[model samples]
Target: MSSIDPMWRLTCVYGELRTENRQRMWNTIVDLKNRSNLPWLVVGHFNEVLWQHEHMSETKRPEPQIRVFRDTLESCGLVDLGFTGVPFTFNNNQSGRKNVRVRLDKAVAIDSWRDLFAETEIKHLTTPCSDHSPIGLTLIKETSQPTVRKVRHYEIVWEKAPELEEIIANTWASLEHNGDLASKFYQQKLEDMSRDYFKDLFAADPNITPDEIVDLFETKVTNMMNEQLCAEFSDNEIADTLF
Candidate 1:
């Protein structure tokens, strides 16, 4: 009944708890598969496992039930995108042998979808509030553009210092301008200049004491509160703020 440009489809499912009732969900997916040949992704809690290893608990899952789910995926041409991080997504939160965990949540994509998103990665992220872990999907598209190299430059207070020009002249004059050695010498001079500048800039002020700095901060805070925070509000202002 609807169409998306570039012909891609996504279906999100929250399956029935009852195995018998889940047949309707599978039937609906199969019906949708017949309608389009677009890149398709089906994701969510299916309430079913495709393999015995997908379920871990005291009681084993019935093979027939898992087989039905596997058969459904095969019929739809949907393959599990696999995942990173914890193997299981659902936890029963019970202690010891009473505990149960299963990979109930997942993302499955058709071959067409795989071709478009060849660099897809699915991550299983756990949350404290929910028993079920959320999954993160990343799709990276291939690009023809070349990666640009990044160059890092340090911002220094050299312009503020009057002796900067003399330092630059002496450093530049001392460098060996033969080839690569000249480049290395220049870099060393730049590092030395930045280090000396920072040392001078952050050197403690002998004129001011720590007590003076603390008093200044306290005075500023008190003045700010008196000018702004301590100001009385009008009845309309209070009403507006409360509202």
Candidate 2:
């Protein structure tokens, strides 16, 4: 292999179906750890779950089974690399209460392997044909440029609102500052505004009650829209609404 190219010991496993047989596989992993010093990555359908949350079924996984798996990982010094996209990797494809889902497929690595590719990303892809979802891994190069910051684009409709200037002036006036402000403060405020988009837009003086805030919006929007604007939304709800 080229000197600049990354290299590691990759082991793909399809664990034994029986609980007793799986224990043998775990022992083999411990033996491998003792023999090899190379950065190691192990991935595949383990046929087991580490936590209750990883499984979704009417019947809970046995505590002893989880404990044994945890002990094996601890002995091997292997840590799970969490996945994105689908929450579960296996599905029974059944309906109603009979249905079951589990995160059985996974990727794990030793500490040195994790440090070697610190920007690794794991994802669980949709499985159309099989019962198990395929796990994918992305190893980001250390020399790669950092991700570009997302630019917050203002809605043209916001500029059309007559109250925009007054809202900005009120917010700036509320800040307690004397001389020139540092650039870091401006940068931080920009980030905050991007994160709390709607919350900051409708924010009022801290001294004003929620009722007073509603009264202020009475002139701007109808009762129904104002109600929605005042209503608290969860992060997921906001993402769903915006996207």
Candidate 3:
């Protein structure tokens, strides 16, 4: 179980139960199902394969255990999300041997809890640390829209312009005095200043070459020691500084 916040308990169990304990364990799970309304996910190495195809080798299938587990899940209104990637989760330790692995790590969720989560992803993560490859399950919360980070783009066209340095120095000084500007404000100001500066310079000389424009801006910005400005500015500061 993993938790990003301290308010909730995310529990996980690995039940390597014998045949006799299966019934008791199932009953206990059912009891737990009735007791909690919070979001809960129960998954791990159950040591029980649900289907014949889950195994890589064609050995005899444990019909009784599979049937019992499936029946219990159905009765409890739980869904087997089935396998996400590789059908099997475990491989026998016999190296280079023709042993088969079966899907042991399973994921199950209640019907009522389905819409609560944005997505449930299950996959096998490489386990160089152990013999068994670890199964990773992730529950992602849904967001209505994609999160966007603010980025400032600047164009400078002035050739050997001393005034450009002063402008940058003044902006930097203002930002330093403000301690930190809001993200939107910083982005807007930075973009506005950059556009205005370039517009004025280009308007003065429409025949300016691209390389000359770049060189002029580079010279002016370097004079202001703006190389580390990107690192110093936060999201908002960057936005404002560019404008």
Candidate 4:
């Protein structure tokens, strides 16, 4: 395979329903991987889950099953492609609390495949026809130039400093004059101020005491502690934890 393109060894799996047979099948797959160091992907129903979170309600998830499934993957050096779209890929479709939901199906690939296809994306689409959801595996081709996404950043230390708030407010006011984006404005100011302040703080006189450190934080930070910790946390995480 060229540096621009990698090879594919797509192995479709439909693990046996029986425990003993499933173990044998898992061993066989492990053996295949051991023999070939090629970049490969395994997509299908594995009849098992590696974590309790993979199954909703947790009524049917036993420790032994999860243990064995994890062991098999560890031995084979295989991992889930970190799917998007859905938490669980398999559902019984039963209504009420009696319904069962588990991630029985997924696309797992070797570490080399991940390294080769850094832009690979696996999405678990809505389940149709059968209980299992159809998974889409995409390998993004090397483009003329990679798309650099806009990154939003906030400093954890700034949340405790009010100076950060002043910098933001002033930068935001300046944005009206410059007609620049909020993200760009914030990042630029933060990067500049953070470097200057931290460098000076570190270059302080040797006679500086612990109390002076707190004093420096107060002067430089600007009481940004009021920014609300919720702003730093994700909406889902805030809802789950706070509410």
- Top candidate by lDDT: 1
Quote each prediction's TM-score. 0.56, 0.57, 0.50, 0.54
Question: Which has the better lDDT: candidate 2, or candidate 4?
Answer: 2
| lDDT scores of the candidates, listed in order | 0.83, 0.80, 0.65, 0.76
Off by over 4 Å in 4: 1-8, 141-243
- Give one clash count per candidate, in the order shown: 0, 0, 14, 7
Q: What would the per-residue lDDT of candidate 1 be over residues 1-243, giving only the tens digit for each residue?
A: 346535688999988899889889889889999998889999998999989998998689999988888999999999999999899999999865678999998899999999878899899986767799989888874568767865546544556667667766765677635457666666666677778877767788788677734643434467777778778888999899999
Clashes of 2: 0
TM-score of 3: 0.50
Tens digits of per-residue lDDT for model 3, 1-243: 347642322446576458778777778778877787766667777777677777666466677888887787777777776546656777774522356787777777775555565387777764434556678777784557766865455443332445666655666676774645644445565666566766665364656556633543434557357767645658997788899
lDDT, residue 37, candidate 3: 73
lDDT of 1: 0.83
Better of 1 and 2 by TM-score: 2
lDDT of 2 by residue, 158-207 (tens): 54556557655654665544235533354455455555556666767687
Q: What is the TM-score of candidate 2? A: 0.57
Using TM-score, give the best candidate's number: 2
In model 2, which runs have C-alpha deviations exceeding 4 angstroms? Answer: 4-7, 141-243
Q: Show the lowest summed lDDT stretch of 10 residues, model 1.
A: 212-221
Worst 10 residues of 4 by lDDT: 212-221
